[model samples]
Target: MLALDNIETFRGPAKILHGISMKIEEGEVVAIVGRNGAGKITTMESIIGLLRVKSGQISFRGENITRMSAHSIARRGIGFSPGDCGLFSSLSVQENLEIGRWHADPKRIDKMADGDTLEKRVYSVFPEIEGFKRRNSLKLSGGQRKMVAISRAMYLCPSLLLIDEAFEGLAPVVISRFRDALKKIKEMGITLLMAESNFSNASLVADRVYVLDRGEVLYEGKPKDAMNDPRVKKILQG
Candidate 1:
C-alpha cells in the first residue's frame, strides 16, 4: 500500500535518513524501532510530507507522492496520529470526532452511511472513551486522550495510517487496549506503519520490523528475527 525507496532527508547539511527503503502491504502492520535521535520520527515525517525529501521517492497506492504536502497526502488516504495526540482541549469528544468526519471521502461516506458504525467500533475498542464522550477532551487522563486521538484518525477511514509512539506514557492496561484496537484496525484493512521505542509491545502487533540506528536502517525482517539479532540486542541495551 505504501513504499519508500532510498529516501533521504537532511536538517540543513546534516543528513538524517540515508537511503531508507521499505514497503508496507495492505492490511499489514509494520513497526519502525529505534532509540532516541535514530531518525525513526524523521522517516515518518518524510513519508507524510512534514519534512521535504532530499532524495529518493515515496509512493502510495502506485502513485508517487514524493513532494506532496501533508494535507494533500492526508487527503490521499493517509492518517497520522502523532505521539502528542493533537487533541483540541476545548472540544468535546463528539466535537473532536466531527473534525475527522469532515476529512472523509464522499465515496466512503456513501458506503458507510450510518456513520454510527465508526463511532461504535471506536468505542468498542476503547470502552473508556464512550463514558467520556460528553466530557471535554482536556479533562481526560493521558490514555483516554490518546484514545480520542486515535479514534479521530480512524474516523477518517483512511487506507493507511502512520502512528508515532502509541505506547508511550501510558499504563500497561491502556497499551493492551491499544494493541487490541490496532488488531481490529488491521482486520478492517487499514495498513499501519508505527514508530515505537517499546519493542515488546510493537512485536505484539507488527507483522514485520525495521531497526534503525544513527539515522540508518540497520536491520529489517520479521520481528522475531530482529529481536534475536545481536546488534538489535546491543542497540536496545545501549
Candidate 2:
C-alpha cells in the first residue's frame, strides 16, 4: 500500500536518509528497526511529509505523496503516534481524543467509514480509556497516556498507522497490552508501520523488518530471518 523509492531526507544541512527505499503491503505490520541515530524516525517523517525529501518519491495507495503536506497525507487516512505519545496534559482524555476526530469529515471517514463512529473505534482498542475519559491527562500513568495516544490516533479512523517506539520504556505488562491492542488493530485490517530501536521489540509485532543503519536500509526480510542474521547481530551490537 506504500512505497518509497530512493528517498533522501535532510535535517538542516545534514542528510539523514540516503536513498532509503522500502514497501509496506496492505494489512501487514512492517517495522523500521535500528539502534539510536539510525534514522528510523527520519525515514518515517520523510514518508509522512513532516520533513520534505531532498530527492526521490513516496507513493501511498498508488498516488505520489512526495510533496504533500502532513495534513494532506493524514486526510488520506494515515495516523501518526510520536515516540513521546504527544497527549495534551491540560485536556481531559475525551477532549484529547476529539482532536483526532477533526481528521474525519462527515462525507468521508476511513475504516470507520463502515458506519461505526470514531469514538467507538478508539474505545474498542482501548476500553480502559473509558474509565478515565473525564480525567485530566496529566493524572494518568505512563501506560494510560500511551493508550490515549493510540486511541487519539484511532479517532481518525485511519487505514495506515505509523507508531514511533510504541514499546519503548513501558512495563512488560503494558507492552503486552499494547501488543494485544495492535493485534486487534491488525485484525481490523489497518496496516502498521512501527519505528523501533530495539530488535526484540520490533520482532514482537512486525511481519517484515527493515534494518536501517546510519541513514540507509541495511537489510529487509522477515522478522525471524533478521533475528538470525549474523550481520544484523553485529550491527546491533555496535
Candidate 3:
C-alpha cells in the first residue's frame, strides 16, 4: 500500500538515491538488499520523511506524502525503526514504550485486525518485553535492545513498518525470534519493508527482493533469483 515513484534524494550536497522506485503491497514483506552506502537507509528515511525527497512522490494508500513531516507520516500509520535502534538509555523499557504509545494515533491501527490496541499488539509479539518493562534500556543485551526498539515502534499501531539494518549483529537464535515476530506482524495485516545487508537472511522473510548498488536498483525479482545472482551474492558476502 506504499509506493515510491522515481524518488531522487540527497544527503547534503551528495545525491544518494538515483530515481529509486518500488511498491509495497499490504500484508507483504519486501526486502531491500545492499552493502553500505547503497542507499538502503536513505530510501527508508526518504519514505518516512526523515530525509526529504528532492524529486518524485511517495504515496501511502494512494495519498501523496512526499512532503509530509516525519511526525505526520508516523501519525499516518508508518512505523520506523532506524538501524541504531534509537532508544533512550536512561528510561525504563516501559517508559520508552509509553512515549511511543502516547505519541501514536490509535486510528492508524489497521482495520482488518481484531481492534487490539498498539500496546496489546506489541506485548503479544514480544512477551520478553513485558518481563523487562522495569529495566533500564541501557542494561539490556543487544538482542533485547533490538526487541525493545521494535516493540516501541509497534506502539504506533502502523499499517506499514519500515526497518533498517534489522538483521545485523544478532545471533542466529535471536534473529529467529525476530523472524517469528515479523511473521506474526504480517498476519496482523501490517506490511513490512526491511533493509538488510545479508541477502541470505533477507531471502528467508522476503516475498520480493531489490538489490541496490551505489544508489541504483541493480536487480528486482524473487528472493531466490536475487540470491542466485553472483553480483548480489558477492556484494552480500563482502
Candidate 4:
C-alpha cells in the first residue's frame, strides 16, 4: 500500500537516505532491517513526512504523498509509533490515547461498522493497557509505555502503521508479546512497516525484509533468504 521510489532524504546538511526505494503491499508486514545509523528511522520519517525528501516520490494507496504535511498524511490513514514511545509525561494513559482519537478523521469513523470503535480496535491488540488507563504515563514501565504508544497509534484507525524499532530494548518476553500483537494487527488487515536494527527481531514478524546499509537498500526479499545470504550474514554478525 506504500511505495518509495528512489527517494533521498536529508537531516540538516547531511543526506541520510540515498535513493532508497521499497514497497509494501496491503495487509503485509514489511521490515526495514539494518544496524545502527543504517537509515531505517530516516526512511520512516521520510514516509511520514516528518523529514522532507529532497528527491523522488512517496505514494500511499496510489496517491502521491511526497509533499503532504505530516498531519495530512496521517489523515490519509497512516499512523506512526516512534522508537522512544512518544507519550505525554504528565497525562494519564487514557488521556494519551484520547489525543490520538482527537486526530481521527470523522469521515473514517463514520464508515466503521455499527459496533466498532477506536477503543475496541486498540484494546483488541493491547488489552493490558486498558487496566492501567488511569495511571500516569510517566509512571508506567518501559513495556507498558511501548504498548501505549502502539495502542495510541491504533486509535488513529490507520490502514498503514509505521512503527520504528518496535522491539528495541525490550525483554524477550515483552518482545514476544509485541510479536503476537503485531500478528493480531495484521490479521485485522492493517499493513505494518517496521524499522528494526536487529534482523532477527524483524524476521520474527516480517513477511518481507529490506536490508539497508549506509542509507541504501542492500537486500530485499524473504526473511529466510536474507538469513542465508552471505552478505546479509556479514551485516547481521556485526
Tens-place lDDT per residue, model 1, 102-203, is: 887757656654654777767776778778888998898888888888888878767888899999998887788789899988877779899998888789
The better candidate by TM-score, 3 or 4, is 4
Kindly give the stretch of ten consecutive residues in candidate 3 with the minimal lDDT sum. Answer: 106-115
Looking at candidate 2, the ten consecutive residues that score lowest on lDDT are 104-113
> How high a TM-score does candidate 1 get?
0.93
Error of 4 at 41 (Å): 0.3
lDDT of 3 by residue, 13-121 (tens): 9999999999889899999999889999999999999998999999999999999999999988898888889899989999988887787775655553576677778
User: Candidate 4: misplaced stretches above 4 Å?
Assistant: none
Model 2, 16-46: lDDT tens per residue?
8889999999999999999898999998888
Model 3 quality (TM-score): 0.94
Better-scoring candidate (TM-score), 2 or 4: 4
CA displacement after TM-score superposition, residue 89 of candidate 3 (Å): 1.9
TM-score of every prediction relative to native: 0.93, 0.95, 0.94, 0.97
Q: Could you tell which candidate, 2 or 4, scores higher by lDDT? A: 4
Q: Could you tell me how far off, in angstroms, the CA of residue 105 lies in candidate 2 after the best superposition? A: 4.3
Query: Each prediction's Cα lDDT score?
Result: 0.86, 0.88, 0.88, 0.92
lDDT of 1 at 177: 77
lDDT of 2: 0.88
- TM-score order of candidates, best first? 4, 2, 3, 1
